[model samples]
Target: MFEWLRVFWQGRIFFLARGDQLPRFLNQALKDGVVLYHTQKSERGMRAQIKLADFRCLRRAARQTHTRVHIVAKYGWPFVAARWWRRKGLLTGFVIIAMALTVLSQLVLSISVSGNRNVISSDVLERAEKLGLKTWAYSKNLDLNQIAKALQEQLPDAAWIGIERNGTDIKIKISEKIRPSIPKEAGNLVASHAGLIKEIMVIQGNPQVHEGETVRAGQVLITQALNPSLPSKTTAPNSAVNNAVARGFVRGRVWYSAEKQILLVEDKVEESGRVATGWGIKFGSRVIMVTTQNSPFEQTNKEVTSPFLQPWRNWSFPVEVIRVNYKELHNVHLERSVVEARQLAEQAARTEVQSKITPMVQIVEENVKVLPSNSGAERVRVEVETYEDLAVYANP
Candidate 1:
């Protein structure tokens, strides 16, 4: 390694020396302190490498010895640099690009969140940004522990939160708090809503009601107790009943109602054919706007386009050209039909009912009604009756 580095720093040249006095020339060159290496005798002449600076002295020695010398090759950084110096502009551009990349590597470009279920990813990212973990933030300026503590304070529901960095990408990992399980021996199953019992399957404890029985909200459908044996009138009954955890599924028919209203008249916007185009240049986080400020239209839809420098590669330049296009828009009053409005209202009603239904519930029957409205708005009402497991655990 040291020899190779030495050769690279002090450029070397390969040359061929011919004639009977080649030996004398070599001796003379050595006497003058010219380093010669890798000397080999060939059929035509002797080939060897000497310091580039010593090549001149070798020519003099070859002339005195009556020997012909010819340069075979040149090698080392100095020669390579000289060759590159011819294309100065390209070299300068490459150097500038390298320096820019070095600076950009320290700045954060994007942030991502993972390992989160109940917590929203955007919420976590927003909190992180507030804590100095946002895009373009210097990596050295951030403290992972401090950011984690801040996030934990804001999201108390998270069991653990961690921040990691990979080049310009920042990753946030979260572990949500685990809810404690309900004890099987300390709760009773009860009806969640008013319904008629359609099926009762007791898995633990004792059953309180049978199928086809009417039950109301908060009514106990299954008891967390052991059944007591029947006692005669003369015999004394047991004072205590074994009250354990009740675990069972009680399916019942439950009803739900949803309503939605739609306006008969509304304003709609339509784009006029006219469009204006403008552009800007973004340097790092700052944008320099170019073109006229005054727009031709009072209302316009604006679109900004900034394409990546290298969309196919993992790394990209921070600089980009932004093009903004504005399209004119005009509003017009439109009258909607009652049938069309009712269809929209019905869709809204069904969405409302679906949002309330749980995984255990199954829809058994549905009914839709269009209400007679004195107001200008049209209203649609939907009634859905479902059969679902009404087993809700409650502390005994």
Candidate 2:
């Protein structure tokens, strides 16, 4: 074996011969750059492993010498196995990881909603869940368009809906229907409060009063219908009566006021109010608390019911919380200061009476009467009474 190694060490060209001619071939072979090695008689043929260039040279020499040669041992099984494993080792692990990630993403874990105003996120998520899209273990074969169509069919109030996937995450975009504004008519309504008439806008009919006109309640501050067409309907029955068409924008003095009662002594009142943290998160069967216990109001115990999907139907998942703590609070009245009381009373009286009357009239006068109540507390009661001449135009 060592001799065979030395014979082929110096980039030697070796020719393998048939077993029968092994000894004869080895004897005639030269020990130069070109050498010959022959195996003993065995079951398998004598195989040759050589560089392509050397193999060509040996073949040509054998042909010139009229010697028949057979090549064997081109590639051994162990060497071929090692080469195959080396080529595939790195890529095998990568392919396995990719397959695992694909399988995991096939199920929906989370859903996000966007572009919604009137519609709440909870509603969108719930509906999305109902449409077979919110399961933690979900099917990647979900048809987005079908899901959207199903949502619209289920929620008619949703103006538009769309669903898409970002890897394992899902996004649902929705837009709520916007109600159209009702058509306004001139002389429909106006502010009767005693404020300098800042501006008067007439949409449907002509303005009865100008921009800076001080008018009284029931006064024709603006007129959608006019009296000029009345005479034509009686005298000339077939004539066209051009009454101011009552169809436009009517805006005038609008005042807002609120008067609240409070004790002279500041008492610590147990005021219960809902303080929404505006933050909430759901994980599995539990919901982590996001709000702190420092809220000024006592929060009533509430059982929050969240829905989880089981491929198609919803399972009730509720979160129950115990009372944490209570904080001392006082009810602070709005516009209840001594200085603001009088003005608030007057404004309140004016708005209360004006809200009940037609906008065609304005509050020309205002009187706030403050009195004492039986509670031994100073009570401020306002009587806002105003008179305006409203023209009742007959329809032609």
Give the winner by lDDT: 1
Local distance difference test, per candidate?
A: 0.79, 0.50
Error of 2 at 27 (Å): 15
Q: Write the per-residue lDDT of candidate 1 for residues 3-90, one digit (tens) a residue.
A: 9999899899998889998889889999888888999999999999988888888877887999999888999988999999999999
Give TM per candidate.
0.44, 0.27
lDDT of 2 at 384: 39
Tens-digit lDDT string for candidate 2 (143-256): 888988788655533545788788778888875443222233222333333433445555445566666666544344445555473765564432224454443222345333
206 Cα displacement, candidate 2 (Å) = 36
For residue 50, what is the lDDT in candidate 2? 51
For candidate 1, the C-alpha RMSD (Å) to the true structure equals 17.5
Deviating ranges (above 4 Å) for candidate 2: 1-95, 180-396
